[model samples]
Target: MSPLNSALFKNTTNDNIVHPDYFVISGFAGIPQTKYYYVFLCFVYALTIIGNTFVMFMIYIDHCLHSPKYIVVFNLALSDLCGSTALVPLVIDTFLFKSHLMSFHACLTSMFFVLGFITVQSFSLAALSYDRCVAICFPLRFNDIVTNKSMSFIIAILWIIAALAFLVAVIYINKLSFCRSNVINSYFCDHGPLHLLACNDNTPSTVMNWACQVVIFWLPVIFIVSSYICITRALLKIAAASERLKAMKTCTSHLILVAVFYLPLCVSFALGGALHMNARIINMSLASVMPQMLNPFIYSLKTDEFRESIKKLYRRKKMHITGRNT
Candidate 1:
């Protein structure tokens, strides 16, 4: 459709208008031996999907984990599985299959999911922090405040709010005119590069973008930090050394998760927007997905209940195999 003819686009002339067939995603275009990068992406997808699935499965089958805490972790694993699945396959295709021919609507859809997952992750992490805060700060009141029914209600509201923010974001972008270039510069359809491609006056969308960022990014960081501080204070007040250590132990996995997700993202976005940092931005963008790979291991290695459940599952499997042979 012509940019001028379309109702969605603002005022535009023929000089800044060309509705190309599709956008070319030239990922790693300047680099040699592109097939090697494709191979590595394959490894990333394989590990991410498999490990996250195992985490979900273990939580499901283990009766010991039928509590609010495990349920929250289960949702995070689900988000990781879905978020990686949504972006990575198409990313591999764009790298290997000469993916310079994706439709405009397809590009928007990919961008939506990529950002949508980040939105889900933001809410998920905040929910996890809130749960931890209640448990650690109010031991006696934890049962009343953090029950399974209440947790479900809170998660529902968090998801609804996040969904609305991303929906508004996509609608805002869709209203703009894109006549700048049909070539996107990232591995996938990130919102930043796509926003840069718009030829229209993008002040509205830019403001909305920042609004969404404040809700989905900065708010979660503030809440997570505040929750951890209270948790730390609570841990310090324990009368015995062993009790304090035990209290701290329960929080270790969550703190690791917060660091794994937030730190890389903050650094990547901060430096990615800096002047003369093209190489650093691309490397950091690649690094952002590393958290999905690390999350399963972090929970499995550090969380006692999950670790014990997995061991019990393994012993059962081994005994079953031996029995069958006998």
Candidate 2:
């Protein structure tokens, strides 16, 4: 069988479709080795949905959470909601319906939105790290520096940059003509999967994609790491044990989020060009899913305030339900 035919059409033996030419060079990897893997994905999806939704609600209903810091958190939670929801449902559809085929437009739209939100989320986290550094290291100036006006500006800038980054990608994609092999290997349409369909001459899009990765992913990650390092060092120098502990808690949570998010994202986007088509798909899925699956839990579990907020929200809900019944 021809490679194009083999990739686009389902193989009876593999029971999965192959990567289309518009995407990357390889096919997907890492189907759940056991039933447990499927269960785990479902669990991640469930928690991601619930956790992000609840976080949104907390920020929405609580007037107190309207501060600059919480605004950043709200955006992060929103991104996580969209990012995970965009991919997981499609993945579930694949598993449940055996319907792995995504329409061409659906594939394109999904790829664009997923990449866009992930980029925006990275920027938001970077902003959050800066906000923490300022709050902790310069407590007196935190309010003045991180005002609502400035916060809105920062969020707007981040979204603009993210939109431009993805928009450039969309334009690049327009240049590539998909001659054959439109089947996407994985459950969702990522840039890698879309690139495989391009004719052999996919240089412009590939280069542009790399450029976006560097600017959109690594640049913010570097700043986030460096800012946190400075924040941690400053906290250590302080004399009060209690104060130091508080700083440590905040800094640690932000750093953990930065690492979890950037590491996999960098890995996946980094491998976008270099790896073979099949291996790239595997790497892409790994990179895309892990950060998203872990994001909601990371933020909720790591922060005491967020956890308490979630608890209170749930308790209120429970009481409301009981009252309705009574």
Candidate 3:
């Protein structure tokens, strides 16, 4: 062992706060053919990167997609890209390559980015819901209420709040003294698993766990559901059935995105201990990654604006290529 590792393991201080130099990430241990799972994650990560980048590129090149709703969609795609990058690559490294050892600060860094981007992803969905709600419920005032500037401000606030919240949780994890086993059971440096390894009192970490659940999961879900309720009422108030259908049609992409993101998570949380440990891990991992991979496709295929923007971009590219060849 190196000198730093020696010092860390010795716990020579009078306070008895033992800080280990590294942690062993025992991800999917004892599971059969875990390599196959890692390969699947590699595919998911690749698709997530390409799909989200394409969505963002479409939004950027086409000025018609510069609306408030597209702003929210862009934010969601950005978060999906980031969240998948934070998680999938590291997971592949740890499990596929058998690089299970993670340094103290590295673990904290991973936890912060993973959780922060995920929280942003959740809030971005809610932001999209709000955009849809405003468009359907207040059609005349949608321009004034949900401008690009206002949408940008909301996204900025969500990113700031998520960063600060996860930063605090990571700071709390840093304060913990890991005197016992440093083996994390999850695929990544998860907050709860890391904090549970601490030898000292973990009340704050425990509290933060529940707080994260409420803030990251429950609150956004409630907001999205409530927004949909408002949207439904607004649609009902429309006199013509065709108008109601048209208004509701605008929400299909966002609703699908919401369902793709939240339903697996809801099932995972609901099943809790009823699931086998490995099964739960698989469910949670899928929940984390599948939405990121699917969000761009859902929006691009379902949203008419995105399809139009894509077609515009394609025609522009074709014209440019023909001009260059001539």
> Evaluated with lDDT, which candidate comes out highest?
3
Writing each residue's lDDT as its tens digit, candidate 1 over 1-326 gives 55643533333344544344467776577667868867877787888888899999998999898788887888888888788888778877776877656776788788777777777777788888998899889999998999888887877787787778777877777776675566677777666666777777778788877887788789999999899899989888888999888888888898888888887677766765563444653564565466777889999999999989999999999999999999
Which pairs of residues collide in model 1?
none
Give per-residue CA lDDT, model 3, range 16-67, as digits (tens).
5677778888878768998888889899999999999999998998889999
* Steric collisions counted per model: 0, 20, 0
Worst 10 residues of 1 by lDDT: 4-13
- Candidate scoring better on lDDT of 2 and 3: 3
Off by over 4 Å in 3: 1-14, 324-326
Pairing residues by index, what is the TM-score of model 2?
Answer: 0.78
Candidate 2 local lDDT, 208-239, one digit each (tens): 77777776677887888788788878888899
Q: How many steric clashes does model 3 contain?
A: 0
Candidates' C-alpha lDDT: 0.78, 0.72, 0.88
